[model samples]
Target chain A: EDKVVQSPLSLVVHEGDTVTLNCSYEVTNFRSLLWYKQEKKAPTFLFMLTSSGIEKKSGRLSSILDKKELFSILNITATQTGDSAIYLCAAPNNNAGNMLTFGGGTRLMVKP
Target chain B: SQTIHQWPATLVQPVGSPLSLECTVEGTSNPNLYWYRQAAGRGLQLLFYSVGIGQISSEVPQNLSASRPQDRQFILSSKKLLLSDSGFYLCAWSKGWGIQETQYFGPGTRLLVL
Candidate 1:
């Protein structure tokens, strides 16, 4: 079975502190890894990493995929209160369309 | 611009009652559709996915079933509900049937079974 695991299920950090969330996967025919930020309703897409060692960045958030290690990490720099949300990592298998195995997710709480 | 909409933002149903949830995508054609369930503070579990009309694939066997009656219309139905069926149901869509394609999600429906 394809599975994705994430570390530090929950974390609390002060404003301006940096945080790192990890995601590792064991999938067959791996294609791409994606990151999402969920606040209340639907989750919003953040980044998509395909090639290993290549970093994808958006503002204060950046992510990288290490296919050899079968893992990925999401880093948030200079965190703010608005950055508090559940971060989800997912990888879609090549044979399954619209089927993505997701990690348990990291619930981040940033306090000011 | 494409958008997905799910009906009945929230629902409360009794055990053994029937269930029907609808999801539709606008501004796209022959898109791949998916149905997923998420427990409280947990990851999403794939229930079913459709590559096209009349083509449905089940990932996990459960009390729920999905159907695609139209090109962009997907429905989740259950003849009898169970307590374990209570959760947040999400609908997602992608442009094509491929792993590289990015999937977009709807606001989702929250179901509570008592």
Candidate 2:
């Protein structure tokens, strides 16, 4: 079975703090990794990582994937309360359903 | 721009009641549709997926079932709801049916089975 694990299931930090969320995966085959931010509703797309080493960034958020290491990391810099949410990491699997196996998710709370 | 919609936004029902949640995609046709459930503090679990009309594939075996009666409309149903059925139900769509395709999500429906 394909599995995705995330570290520090929950985090509480003050504004301006930097946090690094981790996600590791175990799949029979590798395709791509994805990041999503969920607030009180549906999750929105963040970044998709297909290659190792190179980083994908959007404003205060950035993520990197390591195929050999079988893991990925999402970094939030100068975090604000608006950045507070459950950060989810997922990997697309080679299943007939075109499914994504997701991590339990790292819940980050930014206190102002 | 493509969009997906799922309704009713919130539903509360007694246990053993029947369930029927509807999802539809607009601005696109023949897109791959998927149904997922997110329990409190858990990751999204794939319940069903449809590659085209009348082609539904279930990922998990449970009290839930799905149908895609139209190219853009998908439905999740259950003959009898269980308390375990309470969760956030999400619908998604993708242009292609591939592991690499990016799926866009709907606002989601919150189902509460008491």
Candidate 3:
């Protein structure tokens, strides 16, 4: 079975602090890694990393995948209270039925 | 742009009761659909997926079942609700079978079985 593990299951940080979330995977027929930000409802798509070394960035959030290391990291800069949410990482399995194996997720809390 | 929707934002049902959750997509044609369940503090688990109408594929066998009737409509049904079924149910969609394609999620339906 494909497995995805995330580090620091939960974290609390003050405003303006920087946080890095980590996700490592052991998957079959690996294709890509995806990141999402979930508040109280559905998870919103953040970034999709298909290559190694190249980082995908948007505003205060950026992510990079290290295929060789079989891991990915999400970086949040100058965090704000609004940045608090459960960050999820997923990897797609290329078997018969296309599916994504997701990590347990990292719950982040940014306090002002 | 495409959008996905799920109905009955919240539901509370007794054990052995029936269930029917609906999901629909707009502005897209022949999209792949999926059903996922997430327990408290757990990751999303794929329950079922459909590549086309009446072509449902079960990921994990359980009390739940799914169906895709129209091009954009998917339904999740259960003959009998189990307490273990109480959780957040999410519906998703993608463009094709490409493993690299990103799946978009719905608002989700919170089901509590007592």
Best by lDDT: 3
* DockQ for candidate 3: 0.70
Inter-residue clash pairs, candidate 3: none
lDDT of each residue in B4-40, candidate 3, tens digit only: 9999899999999999999999989988889999998
- Interface RMSD for candidates 1 onward, in order: 1.7, 1.6, 1.4
| Tens-digit per-residue lDDT, B36-103, candidate 1 | 99999998888999999989999999989999999999999999999999999999998864443778
- Best model number under TM-score: 3
Indicate the docking level reached by candidate 3.
Answer: medium
Task: List lDDT for all candidates, in order.
Answer: 0.92, 0.91, 0.92
Model 1 chain B scores worst on lDDT over the 10 consecutive residues at B94-103
Candidate 1 regions with alpha-carbon error over 4 angstroms: A96-98, B97-100
Q: What is the DockQ of each candidate?
A: 0.66, 0.65, 0.70
Residue range A59-108, candidate 2, lDDT tens digits: 98999999999999999999999999999988877866677788999999
What ranges in model 2 sit over 4 Å off? Answer: B97-100
Please provide, for model 2 over B1-114, each residue's C-alpha lDDT reduced to its tens digit, 9 standing for 90 to 100.
888899999999999999999999999878889999999988899899988899999998998999999999999999999999999999988776444377888999999999
Q: How far is A4's C-alpha from truth in model 3 (Å)?
A: 1.0
DockQ of 1: 0.66
